[model samples]
Target chain A: MDGWLVDLVAKYNYWIYVVLMMIGFYAMIRKNNLVKKLIGMNIFQTAIILFFISTGAKKGGRIPIVDYEQALAGAVQAADIVNPLPHVLMLTAIVVSVSVTGVALATMLKIYKEYGSIDEDQILERVKNHEP
Target chain B: MNHNLPILVLTFPLLAAFAVNLLGKISKKHVAPWTLASLVLSSVASFFVLIDVLENGTFKYTVGGWLPPYGIELVLDPLSALMLVLVSWVALIATFSALPSIKKEMPGREHLFFSLYLILICGMMGLVITGDAFNLYVLLEITSITTYGLIAMGRGRAPLSSFNYIIMGTVGACFYLLGVGYLYLITGTLNMGDIARLLPPLYESPTVATAFCFLMVGLWIKMAFFPLHGWLPNAYTHAPAGASVLIAPLMTKVTVYLMIRIIFSVFSPQYAFLIHGRVQTLIVWAAVIAIVAASLIALSQRDLVKMLTYVVIAEVAYMVGGVWLGNTNGLTGAVFHIVNDALMTLCFFLVSSAILYRFGSTHFKDLHQLFRKMPITLCVLVVGALSVVGVPPTCGFFSKWYLLLGGIEAGHYGFVGALIFSSLVNAVIFFRVLEIAFSSAGEESVPAEISGSRETHPLMIPSLVVVAIALVVIGINAGSFLSQVIRVAVPSL
Candidate 1:
C-alpha cells in the first residue's frame, strides 16, 4: 500500500493528464451538438498542450535562460534549469490550437446557417428529409 | 545553396500561397498560373533533391542551424522525395483541371480557394519532409484547416459536412500531439531519429505502448481507416470537385505515409512489432473486415463520388494491412500502393469531376451513352477502373500482387483471401458502371440530354489523357520503382 501510494504521487501529473484527456475525448465522441463537439476539440487540444507543458517541469529548477554572471564564469549547470524544449513546443501548440478553434468556429457558423440548428441528430434528420 | 534544397522545396509553396492571395487583388487571372508555376517549380526542386538522394543517399539538414534534439530537421530520402514529386504533379494536374469547376461551383471564391490550395500542398510536403514530431503536428493542422476551408466551398450540404470533418480532424490531430507529448516526456527529444534511438530501452514500458496506440489510432482516424471512416464519405462527396480531386487522393495517402514513418522510422520495426505483434494482428484482421465491408458498402451506393470514396477507404486498408504484415514484401507493397493508389484515385476522381461538370450531377442514373458523347473522359474512366479492379497492364495489379505475396509469406491467409475477394468485388462494381455506360442508349430510362455537348472544357481532355497515359506508363515501369527505389528505402527492423 505504501509503495502504491508512492508510485501514485511520483507520477501524479500523468494520472491527472490522462483523466483530463479522457474527459475531452468523451465529449468529442459523445456530444450531440456540433458546438459542443468543437468545445470538446478545444478541450482535447488544451489537454495535449498541458501535457507538453507538464513535460517541461522539473523540481527546484529555475528559468531556462542562462544567467549572465554564471555563464561568464562557466558555472551554469545543466540541471540548474528546467528543460525548455517542451515549453517552446507548447507555445507553438497553443498557437495551433487557437487557429484550429478559430476555423472550427467559423465552420460551425456555416453549419448553423445551413441547418438552422447545430444538433447532429436534427441536422441528419433534416438532410434525410431533404435533397442535397 | 543546393544543400538547402529540401527547405527550399517546402518554403516555395508557402510563400507562393501568400503571393497568389496578394496577386489575386491585382489580376484574378494570375491565380492559376501562380499556383501552377509554384507547384511546377517545387516539383523541379524536389526532383533535384531526388537526383541528389540517388547520388548521395539521405539528404538531411538542421533547420536554423541548430543541432539534433534541439532544432527541427529537414530530411529527403528516396521515399519522401518520391512522395514529394508525386503530390506536386497530382496537385498541378488537378489545379489545371479545376478551372472549369471553380467557375461553376463557387464563382467568387477562386482567390481564397487557390490560396488554401497552395497552403494544403505546403502542409503535405512539409509533413513528409519534416524530421521533428512536433513539427509534424503543426503541419497536420495546416493541412486540416485548409482542407476544412476548401471543403466548405461546395454548393450543397458542404458546410455541414465540412463542419463534421473539422470536428473529427481536430480530434485526430490532437491525439497525435498527445502521443508526441508522451514521447517527449520519456525520450527528451523531438527529432524522429533521436527518439527512435532513445525508444529501444523503453519499448517494453507501458508508456511507450500507450504512445504507440495513440499515434496509430490518431492516424487511422485521419486516414479514415474503415471503422473510423465516418467523416470521409460525406466530406469528400460534398466537397467541390476541385477540392475533392486535389485532397481525396493525397490526404489519406500522406497520412498513411506518416503512419509508416512512425512504425518503421520513429519506433524501429523490431520494437514496434515486439510491442504490437498482437495489435498488428488485430489491425490486419480489422483491415480484412474493412476491405470486405467497404467494398460491399460501395456496391450499394448510387452517388458515384461517394462510391469512390468507399473505394478509397478500402484501398487505405490495403496499405495499412500490408505494412503491418512486418515483411519486406509487405512494406514494399504498401509503399508502392501509396503512389499507385494516389494516381489511380486522382484519375478516377478527375473523371468523376468531369462527369459532374458535363452532366451537373454524379448520379449513375443520369449518365447513359456517356461513352458516345465524351469518349476521352469515358476512356480515362475505363483506364482508372481497370486499375482499381486490379487488372494486369495497370498499376493496381502489381501492388496487390505484392501485398498478397507478403500476406502469404506472413501466413495470414485470411488477409490474402480478403484481397482476392475485394478484387472481385471491385471488378463487379466497375463492370456494372461500364455496362451502364455502354449499353444501348435506347434502352436506358434517362439520357441526361440537357447538357449533351461534347465540348468539355478544352483543358479537361488533355489532363485526362495525360493521367491515362501516365497510368499505363507507371504500370510498365513499376519494375524499376521496385528494384531501384523501394528495395533500398524500406528500413530494416
Candidate 2:
C-alpha cells in the first residue's frame, strides 16, 4: 500500500493529463456537433498546456524570480526554483489556443450560414444533396 | 553583407501581408500591383539568401541579438533555402494566375484574400528556417490560421471544408505541442539544436521514444498521408480556383519539408533511422500503402481539383517513403522531389485555374473542346500532365527515377512497386482528363470553343506557359540541381 501510494503520487498528474487528453481526442473524433469538436480541441490544447505546466512544477520550490541578494550570497540554488521554461512555453501555447478557437468559431459561423445546421450528419446530408 | 538575408526573407512577406491590408483599405486598386511587386522583392530576397547559404554554409541568425539556447534563432541551411526559393516562386506565379478567379469568385474580398495569402507564405517561410521547436509550432499555427481564412472564403461548401480543416489542423498542431511538452520535460530546452545535443543520452528512454512517435504522428496528420487525408479533397475541390491553385501546391509540400527538418535536424538521422530498423520498415510500408491507395482513389474522382488533392496525398507518401528509406540516395531523392513536386503541382493548378476561368466550371465534362479552344492552355496542361505521369525529361520523371533508385538501394521493393503503380494511376487520371477534353470536337459550335481571345486574363497564360516550360527545364537540368544543391544538402543532413 505504501509503495502503491508513492507511485500514484509521483505519476498522478501525468495520468490526469492523459485522461483529459483521451477525452478530448474522443470528442474530437466521435462527436457529431461542430461546436463540440471545437470544445474538444480547446480541451485538448489546454490539457497539453497543463502537462507542460505540471512538468515545470517543483514541490517546495519558489517562483522562478529570485532575490538579488539571495543570488549574490549563493544561497539560492537553481533546483530550489520552479523551472520557468515550461511556463513560458505554455504562455505561447495559451495564445495559440485562443487564436485557434477564435478562428474555429468564425468558421463555424460560416458553416452554419451555409447549412443552417452544425450537426455533422445533417450537414453532410445537406452537402450531399447540394442544397443551397 | 548578407547576414541579414535570413530575417529579411521572412520579414518581407510578413510586412507586405500587413502593408497590403492597410494600403488596400485606402486604395483598393493599388493592392494587386503592390502585392505582386512585394512578391518580386521577396523572390529576389529569397534568391540572395539561397546564394548566401551556398557561399557561407548553414548560418544561424540570433533574433533580437539574443544568442541560441535562450532565444529564438533562424537557421538558413540548404533545405530551408531551397524551400524558401520554391515557396516564393510558387507564390509569385500563383498570385499572377489568381487574378481572374479572385475577381470572379470573391470580388470585394481581394484585399483579405491577398493578405491571408501573404501571411500563409510568411508562416511557411518562418516554419522552414526557425531552429526553435516552440517557434516552429507558433509559425505553424500562423500558417494554419491564414490557410483556414483563405480556404473559407471560397464558395459553396468551402466554409465547412475550412472548418473541418481547422479542427484537424489544430489537433495535429496540438499533438505536436504535446510532443514538445514531453521533450521539454525531459531535456529542459526548446532550441532544437540544444535538445538534439542533449538527446543522445536519453535516446533509449521511453519518454524520448514516445515523444518521437507523437511528433511524427502529428506531422503525418498535417501532411495528410493517406488515412488522415479526409479533410483535403473537399477543401480543395470546393475551393475557388485561385485558392486551390495556391494551397494545393504548397501546403502538403511544406509539411513534408517540416518532417524532413524534424527527422534530420532535430532528432538527428542516426537516432531517428539507424537506431530502429523495424520502425523504419513499418513507416516505409505505411507510406507504400498510402501511395497506392491514394492514387487509386484519385483515379476515381470526377472533379479535377479534387483529384489533384488525392494525387498530392500520393506524392506525400512518395516523399515519406523516400525519406524513410534510411539511405543517402532515398533521403536525397526525397529532398529533390520536394522542389520538383512543388513546381509541377503549381503548373497543374495553374492550368486548371486557366481552364476554370475560361469555362467557369469545375466538372471534367465541361472541358469539351478545350484543346481546340485554348491550344496554348491545352499544351501547357499536356506538359503538366505528362510530367505528373513521369514522362522523361519532364521534372517528375527525374524525381521518380531517384525515388526508384533509392527504393531499390533500400531494398524496399514494395515501395518501388507502389511508386510505379501510382505513376500508372497518374497516367490514367490525366489521360482520362485529356480524352474527356479532346475526344469530342465541338460539333455544335459551343460559345467557349474557339474564342481565340483567351477569356482568362492574359497574365494568367504567361504564368502557365512559364511553369510548363519550367517543368521541362527543371527535368533536363536535374543533374546540376542535384549536384550543386541537393547533393550538398543531403550530405550535411
Candidate 3:
C-alpha cells in the first residue's frame, strides 16, 4: 500500500490535471450561465496547458539553452537540459485559448443582446417561446 | 516553382484573406472578385500539386528549409493532394453562389465575411497538408474560431448556437491537443511521421492507448459522430445561408479527413484494427446508431436546411462506419464518400440558399410554388436530392455501393442494414419535399406572390449548373476516379 501510494504521488501532476479537467467538464455541462460555461472552458484548456508544460520538466535539469562552446563541441548532455518543445507548443496553445475566450465572450455579448439573458435555461426558454 | 506547389497552395489563400479584408475596407465590390481570383490560383496550384504527388508519390516539404522531426513539414500524398483540390475548388464553386447570397443576406459585411471565409479555407488546406501533429491542432483551432465568428454573424439564435459550438469545439480541440501532448511526451517528437515510427514499440503501453482514445474521441466530437453531435444541427441550421453554403459541406468532412489521417498516417492500420478489434467493432456499432438516429430525426424537421443538416450527420456516420470496417474497400468508400458528400451537401445548401433568397424562409409551408417559381434551382435541387437518396447515375450511389460492399466484406450486417435503412429514409424525406413542391395543392393553399418564373441570381445559376453537372460527371467517371485517385490514396491493409 505504501509503495502504491508513492507511485500515485509520484505522478501527482497528472492526477491534478485529471481532477481539474473533470471539474471544468462538469461545469461546462451542468452550469446554466453561459459565461460560467465559457469560464469552465478556459479552466479546461488551462489544465491541458499545464499538463503540456509539466511534460517538459526534468529533475536537476537547467533551462534548455546551452553554452556556445558546449553546443559547438557537442559535449552537452541531453539529460541535463529540460525539454523546451512542450513549452514552445504550450505558447501556441495559450494563444489559441485566449482567442477562443475572446470569440466566446463576443458571442456571449451577442447572445445577451439578442435574448436579453445569458443563462442557458432562460435563453432556451425564450427560444422555445419564440420571443425574439 | 514546381517544388513549391505544396506551400504555395496554402500561402495564396492565407495572404488573400488579409488582402480581401483590406480591399473590403476600400470597397465591398472588390472582395468577391479578389477572393475568387486567389482561390482560383490556389485551385490551380493544388491541381498541379496533385499531379506532382501522383507522379512522385508521397513527399514531405520542410518549412523554411528546416529538416523534419524538428521543423514543420507539409506531407503531400495522393490523399491530401486530392483533398487540397477538393477544398480549393469547392470553395471556388461555392463562392460563386455565396457572393450573391451574401449580398442578399448580410448586405454590407461582404468584406468581413470573405476575410473569415478565406481564412477558414486556408485553415482547412493547412489541416490537409501539415505533417506536424501540433501544427494540425493550431490549424484546427483556426478553422473552428473562424467558423464560430462566421456563424455568429447571423441573426436570431445564431449567436447562441455559435456559443454552444465554441464550447464544444474548444473542448474537442483541447482534447486533441492533450492527445498530441501525450504523444510528444511518450515519443519526444511532434512530427506525425516521427510519432508513427516511434509508436510501434510503445503500442503496448497504457499511455499510448490512452492517447489514441483521446485523439479518437476528440475527432469524433469535431466530426459530429452520433453521441457527440449535439452542436452540428443547430449551428449549421442557424448560420447565415451564405456561410452555411461554405461550411455545411466542408467542416465535418475535413474533420473526418483528420480522423482518417490519425488512424492511417499517425498510427498503422494494424494498431487501429487488428490490435484493437473490440474498439473498432464498438465504433462501427456506434456509427450504425448514429446513422439510424440522425435519419429518424431528419424526418421530424420542418425546415429544409435543418433537415439537410441531419442528413449531413447521417452521412458522417456512413464514412465513420466505412473506415472502422477495417478493410480496403471500406476505407476507399469512406474517402470517396468524403468527396461525394461534400459536393452533394454543397448542392443541397446552395439550393436552400437560393430558396431562402427568394421566399425568405426554408419552412415547408414557405416552399409552396417553389417548383414553379424556381424551376432551374429546383431541378438542381432534385438532382442533389436524388444523389442523397443514392439513386443511380449520381455520385452518391457509387460511394454507397462501395460502403455497402465494404460492410458486407467486413460481415457487419448491422452496418449494411443501417446504410439501406438510411437510404430509404432519405428517399422518403426528399420525396416528401418534392411532392409538396410539385403538387398543385400547395399553390392553391397559398396565394402565389409572384406571377411568373423567378430564379436566384443569374451568376448563382452558373455555379449551381456546374455543381449539378459535376455530380453526374463524377458519377459516370467514378470508375476512373476510384482507380486513379482513391485506390492510390488507400493505405495497404
For each candidate, what is chain B's TM-score? Answer: 0.97, 0.97, 0.98
lDDT of 1 at B86: 81
Per-residue lDDT of candidate 2, residues B1-493 (tens digit): 3678778877877788888888877877867887888788889999888887888788889999999999899988877888889999999999998866797677777888888888888898888889999999999899888888888888789999988898889888988888887898889888999998999999899998888988988888888988888888888877778888888888899999999888877788888887877899999999999999999999888777878888989999999999999888888888888888898889888887887777766567677766877788888889988898899989889888889999999888999999999999999899988887786745553534332465477889789889998999988998998889888777443
lDDT of 1 by residue, B179-259 (tens): 887888788788999998889888888888888888998899999999999999999999999999999999999999999
**Colliding residue pairs in candidate 1:** none
For residues B1-493, write the lDDT of model 3, one tens digit per residue.
3778888888888888999899889888888778998999999999988988888889788899999988999999899989999999999988988888788788878989999999999999999999999999999999999999999999998999999999999989988988888888899898999899999999998889889999999998998998899999999988988899999999999999999999999999999998888999999999999999999999999989999999999999999999999998899999999999999999999898887777678888778667887899989989999998899899999999999999999999999999999999999999999987886653344532432345767778988899999999999999998899989987778
What are the runs in model 1 whose C-alpha is more than 4 Å off? A1-4, B440-452
Query: Model 1: per-residue lDDT, tens digit, A1-132?
Result: 999999889988877877887888899889998877877778777877777777778889999999799899999987878888888888888888888788878877877777798899998899888774
- Residue B1 accuracy (lDDT) in model 3: 30
Question: Each prediction's Cα lDDT score?
Answer: 0.86, 0.86, 0.91
Candidate 2, residue B384: the lDDT equals 89
Q: Highest lDDT among the candidates is held by which one? A: 3
Worst 10 residues of 3 chain B by lDDT: B443-452
On TM-score, the candidate that comes out on top is 3
Candidate 1 TM-score to native: 0.96
Candidates sorted by TM-score, best first: 3, 2, 1
